[model samples]
Target: MAMNGETKTKAKSNLSKRGSKALTPFSPYIDAVNQAKSCQWSPSNEEGFFLMATAESVLSFDLVHEKIRTCREVPATVGLYGNFRGGDRLRSAIAKMMERTFMGVEVNSAHICISSGVTAVLDLFFFATCDPGDGCLIPAPYFPAFDNDMSIRNEVQPIPVQPADTHTYIPTAEEMEKAVVEAAKRGVKPRVLLITNPGNPLGTLYPEATLKELLLWAVNRGLHVLSDEIYANSKFGSSPDEFISMEKVAQNAVLENLLSAELVAEFVHTAYGMSKDFGMNGFRVGSLHTRSKDLLNFWQNMGMFAAVSNDTQHALAVMLEDENFVDSYVSENKRRLKKSYELLTTNFKTANLHFMSACAAMFCWLDLRSVLAESTFKAESELWKEILEECHIVLTPGEACHYGEPGFFRVCYASMPPNQLQVACDRLTAFIEKKRRKRKAANIS
Candidate 1:
C-alpha cells in the first residue's frame, strides 16, 4: 500500500544508470501479474485469487490449440535463417488479413515488417524515428506499457494529452494540439502521435470523424502517426460505430486532397499482432505496416535482434491461410467475449455500479468513485488494494493506466472462464455493498 502507483521512490543501487532509471516506483499492472502467477483462480482452484487485471483472453485457447495442432510440421527453410524481417508466407497472410479487416485497404507484403511482438514493433519504430528526449503525444488513460515501450530504451518522452472530458477520455484534435504546444513550452520535441484503436481500458472505438480530425492534426504537424491496432478484430457487442484503420483514414485523406499523398506515405503507420485479437500472446509474433522505405530498411536490419522464430511464423501463416478456420475462430472468439462481458456487467448492474459501456476489447472501465473515501488517486489505489486483499481479486487501478481522475478500474473479463469471472464479480459486489453499508452507518452516527 505504501508503494502505490502514483508515487515514485528511488533507492541507492549498483545497477546501470539506465536500468536504475527504468525502475518504476509503482506498477499495479506488474504487481497484478506477479500475484496472478502465485495464486490465480481456476475451476480446479476455487479458493485462489481471481486475476481480472490482465488483458489476455483464455476463452478461445481451445479453439486456437485445435487449429494450431494441424500446423505442427515446420518447413526445411525454418531450419536455417530465412527472412529476418519475417517469413514470406507470414507477411503475405498478414497483408491479406489487414486488407480484409482494415476496411478494404490494399496492404502489400513488401511494406510489412515483423517483430517478436507489437511492443518490439513500437520500440523499433520509435528508436528509428526519435532522438533521445523526443516526445510522443499519447492520450492519457492509455495502455500503461507504452511508457516503457517507447521511453525505456528509445529514450523517448511520452507526453500525456489530457482529455477535456475524462468521462469519455477520448482526445479531440484541439486537445492534441494543446498538448503539443505544452510539450514545446517544456522543451520537449514532439515527434509522433500514437493511437490505440478500439482503445485500451475504454474499449470504445474512435468515431470516424474524430479519427480523421486527429490524423489530420498529426499530418499538419508533420508528425508520424503510429496506430496500435492490436485489438482490431476483437470488437464485439452492439456498438454501431465501426472500427476504421489508420491506413484507410490516411488513404481517404490523400484521395480527398486534405492530406498530401507523400506525407501520408511517409508518416502513417500501423502496428498489429496476434496477441489481443487472436488471443495468441504466447506466439510472440507482431507486424508493422508502413509505406516509408527508410523505416522498412531500418527495421529490416534491426529486426534480427527481435525476429520471430520461423516455426512460429509458419504455424501462424497456416492458421491465417485457412479462411474457414480464421473466420470461425474470430466469430467464436467474439461471441465468447460478448458472453463474458455480459456476465461481468450483469453483476455490475445488480450492484448499481457505474461503468463505461464498452463494445470492443476485453476491458470494462468500472467506476468506483462513489465508493472511494475521496476523489483522489490515493483513494483509488487504497480501494484497489482493499479489493485485492479482501475479495482476493486483482483489478487494474485507474492510476496504473495513468487515468486523469480516480476511482476508475479496468476489469478484464476474458482472462478467466465466465464462471470464474462471475465469482470475481460476486466478490466485488459484496465489497461494494459492504462499503455502502459502512458509509450509511457512519452518516447515521
Candidate 2:
C-alpha cells in the first residue's frame, strides 16, 4: 500500500522534544468497544460507566435552556477575546461558591485563573513549577489520566505513595516521606504533593487531621501541595463527617502556627471544575485557585492558550448566580449520588463482596481479590476481560491505574440510573457465582 502524504510526512519528520512525545492512544475500554462495535451487547458507549460520567445527576439539558432564555439579560458587550483570568463575572461567581465551601478562607476572583479543563490547568501548573525529570507525590490507585497529562509531554513523574497499610490504603506522613525517599533513590526529585480530596476512584475524603499531617509534611519538605478538590461539592454521605477543603486546612494551619500565613499561601494550590460537580464535562471550564501571585500571573499571561469561550463562561456564570436553581441542583444531585451509593453498597452486601467505605466522588474502590484465580496483574487483566466481554459492563481494574497491587477495581455508580445499576449488579453477581461454581466443580473433578 502506498503511504499517504500525511503518513509520509510523519515518517520523515523530525519533531521537537515536546512534539516528539510518544502518543499513548491506548485505552482498554476503547479497544474493547471498538472490537465489539459491529455487534455490541450494550450499544451505547455510555454503558462503559467506569468513565465517571454523571450525566443523570443534574438536569443540565433544561438548565442550559434556561441559560438561553436569560441570554438577553447579559449586556451587549464584545467578548471576542476573553479576559485571561476568565470572565470577570465568572471568576467572581467561582470565588463566591468556593468561599461558601471553605468559609473564612480568603479567596478573591483576582487570585483565580481559569483554563479549559482541570487537565489543562494541571499541565500548565506542572510546567510552571516543575522542571523536566521532576516528580510529584500521588497516592496509589489514583486517576490514571494524570500519567498522560502530567508526565508524557511535561516529564513530571507521578511517584505513587503507597499507604502504610496496604490493605486499607490510608495515606500518611510516614508514607509520604518514604515515597519521597524512594523517588530520591531513583534520582527523581519530588517537588509537589498532589492530593485528590474526595478522591477519584476511591471516592473517599481525607480527614482533617490527615490533611493537616500531609500539609505539614509538604511544608516541611518544601513541597507544593496541589489539592485537587474537583469533587468538593459532590460529597454525599450521611455520616457526621463532611468533605473538608484544604483551603480551610491551610487557614487553620496558619492560625495554629503550624505554618506561617505566607508559607500557607505560597505552598497550597487547588484545581476545581464544573465537570465533576455539575456534570458539565463538555463545557471545558475549570479553574486554578491559588494565592501565589507568581503562579497566578504566569497562568494569566498564558491563559489564552486554552481559554474557555466567553459565551460558555457567561452561561455558566449566570447559572451559578441563580442561588435558587443552584440550591435545587445541589440537593437533587446529592440525593441521586447518595441513592446510587446506597444501592450499590447494598448489592455488594448481598453478594458478600467487600468495598472501601466512601462518601465522595463518583465511584467506589471494590475489593475483588477473592475472585482472582491468582495474585497477579495478569489475573486481574483476565478477570477484567471476562467481565467486560461477557457482561457488557465496565469497571476499571487496579492495574490500569498503575496500582502497586492487583484484584481491586473501580466501579463508577453515579453515571447511570437505578435500573441500569440493577442490571450491572445482576451481571456481576452472576459472574461471581459462575466463578464459584467452577471452583466447586474443579474440586469435585
TM-score of each: 0.96, 0.90
- Over the stretch 267-295, how does candidate 2's per-residue lDDT look in tens digits? 89988988877888778889988989899
Give candidate 2 misplaced runs (Cα > 4 Å): 1-22, 33-78, 102-104
Q: After superposition, how far is residue 9 of candidate 1 from its true place, in Å?
A: 9.7
Tell me the RMSD of model 1 versus the true structure: 2.1
* TM-score (C-alpha) between model 2 and the true structure: 0.90
The alpha-carbon lDDT assigned to residue 350 of candidate 2 equals 93
TM-score of 1: 0.96
Clashing pairs in 1: none
Q: For model 2, which pairs clash?
A: none
